[model samples]
Target chain A: MCFRDAAVRLRAQTIWSGVSLEVAPGEFVAVVGPNGAGKSTLIKAILGVHALSHGEASVLGLPPGQAGRRIGYLPQRRSFDASLRVRGVDIVRLGLDGNRWGTPLPVADRFRGSRRRDRERVAEVLELVGATSYATRPIGQTSGGEQQRLLIAQALVHDPELLLLDEPLDSLDLPNQAAIAAVISGICRDRGITVLIVAHDVNPILSYLDRVVYLARGRALSGPPSEVITSETLSQLYGTPIEVLHTSDGGLVVVGHPEAPAHHSDRHTGRTHERP
Target chain B: MIPSAGATGLSWNVADDVRQLFAQHFMVNALAAGTIVAILAGSVGWFMVLRRQSFAGHTLAVISFPGAAGATLLGVSATAGYFAASIAGALVIAAVPGTGRGRGYTNQSAVIGTAQAFALACGVLFVSLYGGFLDSLNGYLFGTFLGVSDRQVLTLLAVAVVVLATLALVGRMLLFATVDTDVAATRGVPTRLLSIVFLVLLGCAAAEVSQITGALLVFALLVMPAATAQQLTARPAVSLGLSVVLALVIVWLGLGVAYFSVYPVGFYVTTFGFAGYVLAASGRALITWAGTRRRATPAVTR
Candidate 1:
């Protein structure tokens, strides 16, 4: 996807301002920033959901909405009509296919398509995301972590060349985070699907990203992950010197404003709902 | 409930009467109205479930009651009164936030409760001026066909078709918007307009159900089939279709039971509809169990 000087404007405020960026084919990129940054907007703009008040953007050379059939997008969260109960596999089927009206159940006359036809494809994506065993579970019954993986699978089911994931790892534990990251990296490394993921902290996706774009205060900075993931650049972006921590578990890259009040991480341990 | 049939009709113990029943003027009118109302109820109720607005469905039913009663007192068209009150209530529901998962009925309940009380209070005032609503008032509260003319049935069918056609056209997108409305809007599914359209349809459905079964028995037309459809399937497309099918069956069955048992059709339909949901759930469990045994052993060909 190539986004040149793309800016998104909403009625109330400008989300992405004068944003110019490029994502090469098959590149694993992370559009990372703190809360309220234009990372989400920039992505939605590329997806053509939000109108670009400024520049041109394309996915695999086509406009975002036009390119939907070829691009897999995992939104922040996917909710369903409470009464429209569906199994996990069916959720992914919507993505695997051409992002059609919805995954309608088996009926006599309606033709079958790649979305569900990619049965083995569903299993492959499931295994990649470590949600293989939960395929039969109703999506509502799954835990947040499990649901996140199913969402990623739902994205991959279509087998799009470009995957845009917004906050895919939100509210996940470390193990689940690692699993999700591994699945994403595996897709980029093995399947040649370009990944553009959004995240709050850079530490989780640091190892997977070739490039990380930081957005703050309506401005953005982008470069190779190695050069861009730095305390000085982060401090300037946030306007406060931040600590760059290297966690004991061979993890590195965390930056936050020093003067700002430090908040506790709200991570908790919980299992995915075990459905009989 | 009130299971008394024609206390003065000669057809009391008539034998093997298909033509006698299906061809009767009153029977035809009842069947036509029930079928039309059932179709609209099933379709709109499908979205009501998707939007998780059963309470909205129920409250709108409550709010529209006094309209029909007021009309009865004023000797005007009950349908007109119900239509006005229902559309008003739909607008009120729209102003309430989080129509989705409206199990958060507390705030909406307060608003609806106030609306219901005010509407009924005004209706009581109207009734007093007229000095006796009598059987007509009972008809609006519980529902009796004593007041339904054939023209009313035709009018119900006309409104029913319009609502169904609009819903059918926007069927998929509406379902998409109903589930994760933000995503659907992001995908350019016209979220805001769809919400208004859906509420308007609800208003229309409420009016029809309110006029026929009275607002109290609107659930016979609105909630049951859709709720049963929810228990049966989770797919929007499937559940939508199932709701309609279930509604058709329930309406026919309820009408049948009402005829034999001599009761308000709404009472029989509502009770029977709840029974259907219970049956569907248990049937679903049984189907799952039987299917699992066939695939009990996972096979790895690779």
Candidate 2:
């Protein structure tokens, strides 16, 4: 996946401009930043949901959205209504053949082999995500971490070359976040699937990520986490006196200027300030 | 009108009553039409409820009222008007941007509500302008099995075939787009196009149900069966099948009871459907309550 001097403008305002980035196959990349950083917009632009105002972007050797069949995407966090009766396995199966024109034939048909293969693939992905136990249950009844696993399984059911997950770890508890991060990291390594994950907090997956793309103030910087998440780089990116602190356990904590109300409120609020 | 026939009154003998129920030509036509309407409405309403587009479905049903009334005033077939106006209303609703979320959903609801209100007003105006007989008006509003003809039965069948075929072709993709739209789009599902197509199909289903259950109580056949089925099961195939079966039973029972009573078929249909929904809902609640209590007892003992 590659972007060359790409820019996106929504409602006459530039979200991010002149952003150039590339990800190699099987690389685990994380897109991180503070609020209003257009992290999700970048994912959308890459997926061809949002058109770039300038420059060009490509995925899997084709233009954005052209290679959709070869891409698996998990959008930002969405809570299923408690009354929703859809099963997790069905959700996973949808990811495999949901775009097909007709419904699946019964087991008595000539296409029984293909149908079995579809079910097998769904089962395999569910197992890979460690959600096979509760996958038959209603998705709404599952815990947050379990639902996330099912969604990731859905994305992985059809073996895609590239996976784009927007905030897959959002709203998850710390242990579940680490566990999900490990699963994603394993998929990237074993299946040779390129992953671009958009996340707010980078602590949980810091050790597993191959690279980081940090965006702020409509600009982006991409490098190793160690280099890009430093005080100097983030402060430069934010255009303010932001601090990146290193704890004894090798985790990074980002603190913004206390007096700068616009950026400061987001650091501790836990509320995601989405781009309008 | 046909003269009063033998065995019109309900009897204690179950088989005899059923035989009497299917004896008449009009009864057969009504049964056929009701069955077709039930299958179409049940299948389409499953997706309607799943997508949370019941409001849009209701609006389409309301729009069919004006469509049928206007067609009557214009000396055209009411069925033709139903199709035309319902599809047009669907297009208008589809033209509004947004995929039923956030600010766009609010605007979409406002637009749908306004269209419904205008449709009701237009239906009243058309009825008043025609100054049709009170019986025909009542038939249009509350529905009548006696008025269902062999031609109407065939028309309903034709529409059902087309609608169900189209639904079968698009049902899988539609389900994916309905549940997980953003990801479906990213996976090449054409979410926008599917949305429009589903709405048009829903409009057709609503219009078809209106012909049987009447404009005022279309939800009786369209929503209740599917809603009740979802309460009974979480499995898509099972729930959808249950929805169709429930609809079939409701329509059959409604027709049978209305045949022997002074009340309209719509009242009977709506009453039976509501009863089914209430039963399913309470059954679900009872099961949940029992399971929680059992779990709580185990924990307390531990």
Candidate 3:
């Protein structure tokens, strides 16, 4: 995947501009940034749902949206209403043929042997996410972490060559965060599918990061975590005194970052606001 | 004619009532029409409730009032007018400038409300200008089930078939779009087009249902059955099928009861539909309450 000086604008405000980045095949990249830094806008551009004000983005040698079913996405976490009638396994099945035209006529499926094939695939993806126990349960009844796992199953049901996740760790507890991160990294290694995960904090995914694309103030800097996550890089990025601390437990933490803009934090929770 | 039961008022003879209900040709036509409307409304209203487009669907129902009234004044079939105006109303709603994201709800509602208000005014104007007979307006607004001709039933059947076939064709993709719009669009599901198409289908259902429950009470068939089924279950296929069954039951019961009473079919249908919804809602609440009590007792003992 490659973005050449891509820019996105909504209304009179320019969300971000002149951003460029590239990810090699089988790479796992994290997009970490403060609120209102246009991370979502960048994802929209790459998904080909939103037009860029300037420049271009391509996935697998084709324009963004043209990647079609080959690019799978796990959207931001929003609670499904309890009344939603779709089940956990059905959600995964949607990723398999949701974009295809025509009805998934049951009779046609029976004739073509696709129904059994689809059922097997859905089962495999559910097992991979460890959500098979409640696969028949309604999505609304599941916990946030369980729902996240199911959503990951949905994104992987199609076995896409490229997978993009928008805040796959939001609202999750620490253990869930670790589990989802592991699932994503495991998928990357097992399937050789390129992954780009956007998050407010990069710590949970630090262990698996092949590179980090940190965005601040309409600018993006991409490199290995050790190169871009230092005190010097983020301090310059946010125009404040920020410190990247290495803990004794083999985890990394960023300290002394400025308080986030009120609107920005309100819009996107789960950001790295810990002041330790 | 209601059969009297010795000293106990009305008899509860199911076999006789079933025979009497479809005794007349017009009654059979009404039964057939009701069946079609129930199935179409049940299917389409499921999507309407799921997408939270009930307000938009309600606006289209209101649009049918002026449509029928204008057709009456112009000496045309009210059914044709109902469909034409409601389809136009759907397009207008779809054309409203908003993607229904965070900031678009108020704008979309404003547009829908304005259209509804204007349509209501037009209906009043058209009714006032009609010189033939003012009582016909009541039938359009309140619905009349006693005099449905065979031709009208056929028309309803045709429209219902088209709507149901279209839904079957797009149901999967539409469900995906309704459940996870952003992800579906990102995966190339054409979410915009799907939404617009669903809106058009809602309009079609509204127009057909208005013929039985009237423009003012179209919700009797369009919303109640689907809402009740959704309240009762959380599986799409089961809920969808249950919605249709409930709708058919309501319509059948509504027509049967109206045959023996002085009230219109619309009133009975609306009453029965509302009753079903209330029953489902309270049933769910009761289950929750009982479960909570059970859990609380165990905690208290510990």
Best by DockQ: 2
**All DockQ scores:** 0.28, 0.68, 0.55
Question: Compared to the true structure, candidate 3 yields what TM-score?
Answer: 0.90
Question: Candidate 2 on B1-302: residue-level lDDT in tens?
Answer: 12243345888699998899789888888889999999999999998998889989999988998999999999999999888989999988988877433112357888789879999899888988999757556766777656787878888899899999999899889888888887777777788888888889989998899888777788898899999998998778778888899999999998888777766778888999999999999998999999989989978998
Over 4 Å off, model 3: A4-20, A51-57, A102-112, A236-241, A256-264, A269-276, B1-13, B99-104, B131-134, B293-298
How well is each residue in A1-276 modelled by candidate 2, as lDDT tens digits? 989999999999999998999889889999987667899999899888899899999888888878877888998877676678889998999999898988643432345777888888898999898999999988878888888999999999999999999889876778898999999999999999999999878888899889999888889999889999998988887787878889998898887743343552344344332211
The regions of model 1 sitting more than 4 angstroms off are A1-20, A45-71, A78-84, A89-136, A156-161, A235-250, A253-276, B1-20, B70-76, B95-113, B278-302
TM-score against truth, every candidate: 0.79, 0.93, 0.90
What TM-score would you give candidate 1 relative to the actual structure?
A: 0.79
lDDT of each: 0.71, 0.85, 0.83
Q: Judged by lDDT against the true structure, how good is candidate 2? A: 0.85
User: By TM-score, who's the top model here?
Assistant: 2
Q: Identify the CAPRI category of the predicted complex in candidate 2.
A: medium
**Clashing residue pairs, candidate 1?**
A84-B234, A85-B234, A96-A157, A96-A158, A97-A115, B3-B262
lDDT of 3 by residue, B33-141 (tens): 9999999999899888888888888999889889988997899998899999899999888888773331233578887898899998999889889954457677777
lDDT of 2 at A29: 96
Residue B224 of candidate 3: its Cα lDDT? 97
Q: Which residue window of length 10 is worst by lDDT in model 3 chain A?
A: A267-276
Evaluate model 3: give its lDDT.
Answer: 0.83
Candidate 2 lDDT score at position A236: 85
